[model samples]
Target: MREPYARYLQLLGFDQTPHGVEGLRQLVRRHVIRVPFENISKLLLIRRERRGRPTTLNEYLDGLERHDLGGTCYTSNPFFAELLRELGYDADLLGCDMTRVNVHTAMRVRVDGSAYHVDVGYGGPFYEPLLLTDSPHEMRQGPYRYVLDRARDGRLAMNVFTGEERVHGYLVNEIPREREFFTSIILDSFRPAATFMTQLCVFRYFEDHAVQLQNNVAVHYRAGESGETRISSMKEIREIFENQLRLPRCPVEKAIKTLEQLTGQDFFAMGEGDLYV
Candidate 1:
């Protein structure tokens, strides 16, 4: 049988035929760079018409192919796991306690008798897979260096430092999980009170740079350079999503309206290119 993602690899800008361990790494790199980590469905109030059934794998693929969008941890992990399995890999889904209270999903893969943690939805912290081990290991890509260590609770903690701040870290358990484990949290994320419903966030990671848009602020950081941020107007936000983030234009207005509802700002009243940060 043909792999589900065999055709889409070209869409992600790959021409070489990849196989084995290197193939796994290449697949992850292409995915993280091309498919942004975003929650446009929650922002736009779009829900799958499952009629009380759990979301299916086909639904996740449709979201990516038809909508030109990526999803939160729940959707992204399941989708990625399926792609990996279809391509022939020993892959499983793992849940992490991002805040030690909320669960985040990632992939654990065993390739060539070695275990690795592959996380495409992590946005920036992980641009590549890290060796899955109890001992500390560092992987540096571009300007950021990520450290992976085992926490006292026996979970792998992925940490990264930006300047004086320990900017990002999350704890992932070694145990594998299934989609049913994240069902409730996935539902909660779309609720009105959930942060996903109110905030506007989009992140795109590349080999040397990354762009993040949170609420009305946009930041672009490059290797060996200080990050720069600016307050974005509704128009500017749309432009960034379309041109910079490489997302479809259809969801821009809905996302902007959602941000307006969250911040109570009249973006039209603001001056163009005004400094926000």
Candidate 2:
């Protein structure tokens, strides 16, 4: 394996030896908690060039090292699948429909002849490799619960819920797709009105809690507790990114500036109603 990628696996707290399914679980779990799901790079790229580029794997890993940042499905999932392959795992790249047309990337690993669904992006739908079974399987992590079901289209459907309310539905495509297939969507996400570019959405999932930052508001919560949401200052926001989220210092500063330009609000004087989760 390459040095930087090897060091990245170690950064996620893995040993020098290859771990089987257990290692995959550890990688999936730690990747989310350590690398934030944010679009600061896209935001920065668009801010300067008014367009996007193909997000390369090295760029994604370098962002994690240089800026402590994470990319969307396009960057995160493909890199993860590559990591698994480099480490000698049978990993299959998969794509899904999160929106009507937009695609979300994930992967499936056939370990010991059993296939498991693995997603290290789009937050914490699967902190572990979920057994690909026709029967419904529900897994809970921190404050949220997700139900996995096989759809009629031969894909897997992951239903995200909090308590009794269904929050989101993701339908995994039955047919697997390659990483390069998602290049267009990656560029599309950086368009002026795209969600990842315009919104300051940051998510970090842990075993104990999940933290989210949308626009200027930050929410931290766990299961059984009403999450706390408050309008945050630039200083406080930086602290959250660096401390709570474990992101590097530089990119976050740039992210703040880009956000101010996008929202036309002063973070220093912002109030509660200025943002949302």
Candidate 3:
């Protein structure tokens, strides 16, 4: 495992031995703070997204391996556990069902008798792991601050303060690692009426902040200042492949054409888009 994850740890600036919860926290913080999540490596996989056959974790990793783009929470959380093991931290890879169409994978670490959710993956949900406690907290970083309040209803509610103001945003539930996790997320995603109200989003939570990417928008929220940047375009999604994410010449045209065909709209038109990212 050490040999396999050596390159990744080095890439994430965790090439040293990182023991205990603080170490794990630092490791995750480094990953999310550095890596920018993107999907342009579809060309490297050369496998098109087919109906009922979304790209799995293995495929995404393979795509990243081929293109040098790497992965976000979906692949990185499990990889984080591998590194923690090398550092002698008790960690495990757990799968949580967040929605019907999305099954999120994360790392659970127990260090110094306290458990923390270390997920540097899942770009739209969290950025680092959260201490599983019922509390209101703010994660503050330079020029960004994101807030989370555990609702009385036991729902993990959050809002991305986009500098200008607050907006109705993400709703998260911390599902346990269960055998039915995969199926549950699928059931939630495809239910008769889904209410996520965002694009196909993923998240990573830190102690006080979370980082997420919804479609082409990248949001960094902690506790003080916040940064929201338009990282992609619904109209120019094809260009995103060619520019920001850097996809192959083939997949760019293919994804755009597929999106266009599905929505009966121009692929480069931002005015017309779907909730799914």
**Candidate 3 Cα errors over 4 Å, as ranges:** 39-59, 68-74, 78-87, 92-107, 124-128, 132-135, 140-145, 153-180, 183-254, 272-277
Per-residue lDDT tens digits for candidate 2, residues 1-277, read: 7866787787677777567778777777778777777767777776777678877777777777777678767778888888888888888888788755447878888888888888877765466777786458887654567888877887688877778987776888756677878888776776656666556677777777777776667767677453655655667777777776666454766766786687676744444331212
Question: Mind giving the per-residue lDDT tens digits that candidate 3 earns over 178-255?
Answer: 323444453343332332211223333445665554445545666654675564454454443344333333243443
| Residues 187-215, model 1: lDDT tens digits | 76665546665566677776777777666
Winner of 1 and 3 under lDDT: 1
Question: Best by TM-score, which number?
Answer: 2
Q: CA lDDT of 230 in candidate 3? A: 64
**Roughly what TM-score does model 1 have, to 2 decimal places?**
0.81
Which residue pairs collide in model 2, if any? 143-223
Residue 8, candidate 3: C-alpha displacement in angstroms: 3.1
lDDT of 3: 0.49
Candidates ranked, most accurate by lDDT first: 2, 1, 3
lDDT score of model 2?
0.72
